[model samples]
Target: MLRNMLTRDELIQWMRTELPRLLQEDPAFRAQVIGILSEALVSKGELTRLLDELRAMREESQRRFEAADRRFEAIVEELRAMRADFERRFEEVDRRFEAADRRFEAIVEEMRAMRADFERRFEEVDRRFEAVDRRFEAADRRFEAIVEELRTLRSDFEQWVRFSQQEFAALRVRVAEMGIGLGSLGLRMGQGLEEVIRQVIESFSGAGPLKAARLVLIDEAGELYQPGARVEIDALVTDGRRFLVEVKNYAKTDEVWAFHRKARFAEAKLGETFEKVLIAPAATASAVALAKQLGIICYTFRAAESRETSE
Candidate 1:
């Protein structure tokens, strides 16, 4: 009985290989196999029900599988669209990057050109500066030479100025000495005239020669010859009357006025009448007029010169 039982694959293999031979050659074995199979298999009603359930399960599984297949195809189509869009965007980005690279290369080339031009200009400027420096150096040398020449001229001019100053000093000293000599000669001539006047007074008035000459006069304070204490008198002679005389190389109005004042003062102090006389080699017209106005006598050496020449 255990051997008679057949597995599902053994039953299917026997049906495929031996069922035809069994139906023709062994009708009784066929009936026996049918009975064994009938016992091993389910009842017809149960088999029908099982087949219906299997059919329904197959239809459901088929519907589910088709729906899954359709969903997978839709997903695949959407992924393909997304990939195409990404590829197109990537291509556009690549084109933009290429354009940017070209623009950067142009800018870099322009910068290089500008730098080259700047270098050339700088070199030209340097050459110009060098030329200007040379000119300045030449001007400086010329200015220094001019300064040196001016210094030499200044030295020569200073020497000339010093020599001129020395000459002027010597000329001034000579003029001063000549003035002193003329003053001394005038004094000596005045003294000689005083002696002559004394002789004339003794011969004309019969007053004997004066005993002593009055070199100075006195007042209550001191000697009257204060302003000209060092100076000698021109003439001083007395014949019981006072006489005042003044001599000069050249007499002007000022000398005549001075003589008048001295004569007036002497008369007031000595209580005697005084005779005033002025003598000079030449008298200015103003001195002669002033002498006549003041009642003083003026004697000029020019008259004596005329007389000597005439004789």
Candidate 2:
């Protein structure tokens, strides 16, 4: 008959109870079972040893895997730190570049402003220069006008001087002709006076000749006379004053008796109280001395002759 194989738990329980029972009931079977059991125990010990070895190998593999995992984590942390450092450095470099760009842009703007300011100043300077040039042109025009006016004035002055010189020359010629005519008329008048003076002298010789004679005459109504005549009159009058007259026309005398006679006649005409007698055509030194003693005045026609003479 086939016996039932024990279940794992039931076989473990049956081997504990039945193996002891079979040993008690059958010695030979008990010995064979014991030997098999001993063999099974040996096999189980070997399996336990193998299992422990496998568990030790698994623990060693886990330890090695864990260590490798920790090393990998450290390497990952290092890589992350390096990546963070690189990113921060890149950000700093970018910020610096941005700041530099802003500075460069500001500098460019400043340069543009400077250029504009310079252009404005240059334009102002150009305008000022243009104004100066205009002023210079105006001044030049004024100076030219002044020069033209001066030239005109000089020409007028020269013309005036020339005209004045011509007028002066004509005036001088007219004056010379007037002088020559006056001198010729004077010579003719002197030539016509000779006989009239002789008649006057003959009238004075009559007895009891007047103490004074008055004759009022205009310039051109006199009778004509000769160039040389001498007349003595007892009395003559001019402006109501009685004077003894000795008329002379181109007659000169140095005789002292002639002047003494004139003074004596003046004394008789004035009743011995006459101051002087006039002797025309002034006498020489001896005549002047006698005239001085007898109280006679003497004059000459030389002044009238000088007036009639031509230059």
Please give, for residues 241-273, the per-residue lDDT of candidate 1 as tens digits.
Answer: 656666676677776776776666667666877
Candidate 1 Cα deviation (angstroms), residue 202: 7.9
Residue-level lDDT tens digits of model 2 in 1-311? 11365567887887888778889999999888879888667677788999999999999999999999999999999999999999999999999999999999999999999999999999999999999999999999999999999999999999999999999867754543343334334536654222332233334343223344422222232222232333344235332334445444322333345545545534544465443443343234444545566566543322232222223
Output the lDDT of residue 154, model 1: 95
Write down the lDDT that model 2 would get. Answer: 0.58
What C-alpha lDDT, on a 0 to 100 scale, does residue 42 get in candidate 1? 92
TM-score of model 1 (CA atoms): 0.30
lDDT score for residue 230 of model 1: 37
User: What C-alpha lDDT values do all the predictions have?
Assistant: 0.69, 0.58
- The window of 10 residues in a row where model 1 has the poorest summed lDDT is 302-311
Error of 1 at 274 (Å): 1.1
Any idea what lDDT model 1 has?
Answer: 0.69
Error (Å) of candidate 1 at residue 193 is 5.9
